[model samples]
Target: MKIYLLYTGGTVGSVGKPLGPLAGPRFVDAFRANVETIITSQLPGTTINYDYFTPTLDSTNMQPADWVRIAQKVLSNYKKNDAFLVLHGTDTMAWTSSALSFLLPGISKPLFVTGSQLPLFFEQDESYTLLFNTDALRNVLGAIQFMTFAIPEVALYFADTLYRGNRVIKSNAREFTAFSSSNYPALGRYGVLPVLNERLVRPAPSTNALNNHIQKVAADLNIIMENINRSSVIQFLLFPAYYDRTSGDSLIVSMLTQLSRVNPPLRGIVFESFGEGNIPDFASMQALLMDLSTSGIILVDCTQVYAGDVNYGAYATGAWLKGAGVISGYDMTPVAALAKLVIQLARDPSSPKDEIQKAMSTDLAGEMVIL
Candidate 1:
């Protein structure tokens, strides 16, 4: 089978140090040198085609433009390949995968985003030297096999678990299982062999006409247009856990004041509020939010808690904020909430404001977990 591999440098391709993750000089060649035996010996006849970003940046420094590049890259070669695999950094891999879910809804082929917390080529000790990690190499190889199953929706595969892309999150930094899909079950799991829970997987649209329609919608977004920008959304997270009475209100006031001053106004917002969706109730916070909402900023909230969906009227503290046009993000990850908003806002033919709101609330890509 043929697959398109996108290598946006990260721990996956590194040997060690400052030049390691960035693909400085000839890191790709070095990485291939390390894993060539396994790729050829175990995964015998698979034809893998790869593309490396011109100047790969650490995922920590991953930007909005990077997401656009990734989407465009996939679209450019969508018809030529049977499947796609993205070798991304663990740091912002979930964020990129989440963005891709909205960017390519009803995707026709299996698209898997995979990475290693411990570098697959090699690792580092106290002196910043290369120490090869075979376990990571195994994980990468295992994931490659899984991608051939024709899984339709975008998903992230790591640590023996394949999760819905938008549902997954990077929950750990130092552990082998560095990711989690708290709100949704994994689409597949790997043991001696891959076990796919097809019931959980969203099937691709059966008709090619439907598939082409979806692809055309995405293609329209990539066309360059004057006075238009795709990255026209913002996000805010209200940290109730670390706030005092005075700081909370004052902080909210300052943040709102700054948001109002942004020129041309934002298209949408991912407002991450407290447990079960509770935003601050200070008079200034309420007033400013109402103004932004009326200004047509589509504000939506996901919870800071790991498990529950957002329930707006559970308490009085945040009830007033609802009237300000805040929509619940249900059980979506923060990255998903933001990415989806940016996507619908940028949709071509100028997706109506109400239609965008309706789309966000609906489960277009198995992102929403209805309770």
Candidate 2:
């Protein structure tokens, strides 16, 4: 079986260069040379052919357009190959992997996305030491199709563990232990051999070709993400802790005001309160929430906890926030809620006060656990 390799820019493709910061390691030549010398030479009999995305790009600057490009490339080469291996950058690797898992619905091939912390050409000879001598790459080539679902999803392989993209999160910056499958179990492991854990790798349904089609969900869905910017309309960032108002001192007030002053448009706040999603509805805090709700800015109450559904009606504090128009973020992480809010601003652009709240309560990327 032929394994087609797709090389996009990442630490894996970087090489030593003269410049100071950005010139650390660069992909100066075709990736095939590195694959042959670093990967194939040591493995000696692995059946894998390679290809590279022209003008390989740095993974840090990866965007939504890049995900679309990756899907298109895989589709272009879908028929000719038995399996695919994508060399991606570690940073934002989980986000891209999740995006691809959702975007490319009906995949039947073994699509493995892997990368290194230090570039393959590191002076330490670290790439050859860890990768070339191991059976990790060779074993994945055995199963080309998604085991359970008809459409195979994308995954990240690092530090000898294969994790589901949607459940994986990047936790480190400088180590090989860069990602963790926090909310899920490892699909498999790579030690002396690639040990396939049957319990974790789900089985795929054998479906016909006509049943496969790319779902056009993006154009119809309102999706976007942005960091705080000069023109950003975001204001309040509600901290989640469902409890009584125990810690509302000058420090909290000063910090919130300072944050608002730096980017004044973000004019609302919500606290993912304590148990059952409750927050102190003190007279002053209640007025602040009500005023923000009235002023057309977004104020949300997300859960600081995890692994459970949000219960807006479970406690008196939660009930009060609901009455005050403090939107419930359900189970969304702060990052996801912030990103979703930014997307809403792009979706309607001229949305009214209540519309933003309504949109946040809904599930767009299968993000929230609405009860």
Candidate 3:
């Protein structure tokens, strides 16, 4: 079996020496020599191919477009390899992995993504040296088939636990245990024997080749957090437990009012609602939110809760909000919803205001729950 190692710049591939507080290590010829030596010595008979990105990048510099590139690279190589391994930077690994799972729909091979906390060039550890070897990976291939890879979807493997990418959030900046999937458990543990957790993995879809089955169409999603331009599109980040507070109410109004004043009028608003879709029933809050919806801005009732389905209009308060023009957000996360809204808004600024309502409810990137 041939394993292709696609290296996109990250700490794992970075080589630089510190110069006081601002200095970074440079990737010298010795760095490559060390890596090659370790691979050659540890995996005696295995064949491994290495490719570097045009220009290495720090994990902080990662974007969705970068993910598109990585996915394309894998798709391009689907015919020649039995399985693939990606050495990625941990910073945005979860986001990239999640995007890949969506972009590459029917992946059938072991597309394992791993990287060390310390660069192989800078560190000296048995784990990094041993794990980087083809032998370390070859031993696990007998049991890692298409079905096993599907479980936990595209996962982030670090510090022992393997977590589903979409569910994982970056919780640390310096530690090896940087990624965590709080809503879900590790898909499987990696130790003496990698235990397969069938329940967590999704069954493979019907497809001839994993590469050709991907949805090549990429979404033009935007993640608006601080940049609320004078554009007609606006979304409010609402936490359920705090939606009742005067502060939350004010934020909602400020965002709505600001958008309404923009040229061509605002398109919609995504209310990042709290747990299982509950919101404050205060008349002031209801009127303010409903007024924007009635005025043609889409009001998406997204849940702030990390897990579970959002039951919009389930309670009297929820029903009142829904009746007043709020659409159930279902189970979309704030980041996903915001991105979806940006995509929709960009496609058609004058989109039948109902588009936001619809997109937020749909399961794009497996980021939302249908039920």
Candidate 4:
């Protein structure tokens, strides 16, 4: 068995009082010296290869360009390795995983992203000591073990569960179980043995078609990277109205008005609307959104609630958003919706507004449940 372990500095590769990431090469050396033995002993004959991003970034500092870099690396080495594992920061790991799923559609091998809430190693008397009780090693080992099963999709492994990459969200900051895939079931669960829920895994594409798709993606890699770097997509969380009765417009409407006029113009918006995708029925709000849609800004209505679909037709207050050209991001986490928009826009910047909206409404990577 062969695995490509790409480390993009995270809590899993850090040590010390302040919890900062270690230099990539240094972390690689430390892992080989301290942890490789355990892995090698358990998974005998497995050959693990290591790579890292130069001057590793904290997950909070992760950007769209970084997602492209990760995708490129995986694609470039797709044939050489049997499985891929990404050591990412918990903060934005879900975003990276979600983006990768779109960037590498129909991936036929296991790709797992995992990170720890606490540093993988700790300083004890001026020397490094492995923290056995920490979630870092457990998660890493779990991912490595699960890789042998060849689950064919981009997935995130943490807290003893494997989830569809785009279906997950970072729901907790302090717990080992930091991610939640509330709308989807675990692809696999870890106990004494890894038990995969085979029904939930995406069926692998045929070898020839998978290779052809990858070749096409590789051909357009540069354009995709450039588009992603220049892409302008933002998420807005709608709140209760604070109205200025004299003006008859809420502050939310005023803010949207300003946002609509930004330089270079806004390309897309992932509006985190209230329960079941309802937004205030103010006239000003509806007018500005319609104008923005008319002006070619893609609007995706996503639910702020953690575990429900955005059924625009379910409520009168929400139905107007659809009439104004807003599309439903049914059950997608805000992160997934945001990343999907960015990727779709980058993939086809010149595409018409309805085309982009259609892409958003479609489940390209199991990110949403379209009802």
Query: Could you estimate the TM-score for every candidate?
Result: 0.88, 0.59, 0.66, 0.96
Q: How far out, in Å, is residue 99 in model 4? A: 0.5
Q: RMSD of model 2, in Å?
A: 6.8
- Write the residue-wise lDDT of candidate 4 on 52-106 in tens digits: 9998978989988899899999888888889999999999999999999988876
Sort by TM-score, top down from the best: 4, 1, 3, 2
Best by TM-score: 4
lDDT by residue for model 3 (23-108), tens: 12233233345554444454455455556566767767876456667766776776677666666777666666666665565666
Compute the lDDT for candidate 2. 0.55
lDDT of 1 by residue, 1-371 (tens): 67788888887766645635745345556555555556667667777677878787678878766777787788787878888888888888988899887776558788888878776654334223234453466667777878768878788989888899999888988787989988999999999899999999886676642257645745654652222364367777786433245545576667656876676557777877888888877666777778887877788888877777788778776677668788778888777887777667656426666788788888878888766
lDDT of 4: 0.87
**lDDT score, candidate 1, position 148:** 68
Clashes of each: 0, 25, 8, 0
Please give the distance, in angstroms, between residue 309's alpha carbon in candidate 3 and its true position after superposition.
Answer: 4.7
In the predicted model 1, the residue pairs found to clash are none
Q: Which pairs of residues have clashing backbones in candidate 4?
A: none
Candidate number with the higher TM-score (1 or 4): 4
Of 1 and 3, the candidate ranking higher by lDDT: 1
Error of 4 at 247 (Å): 2.6
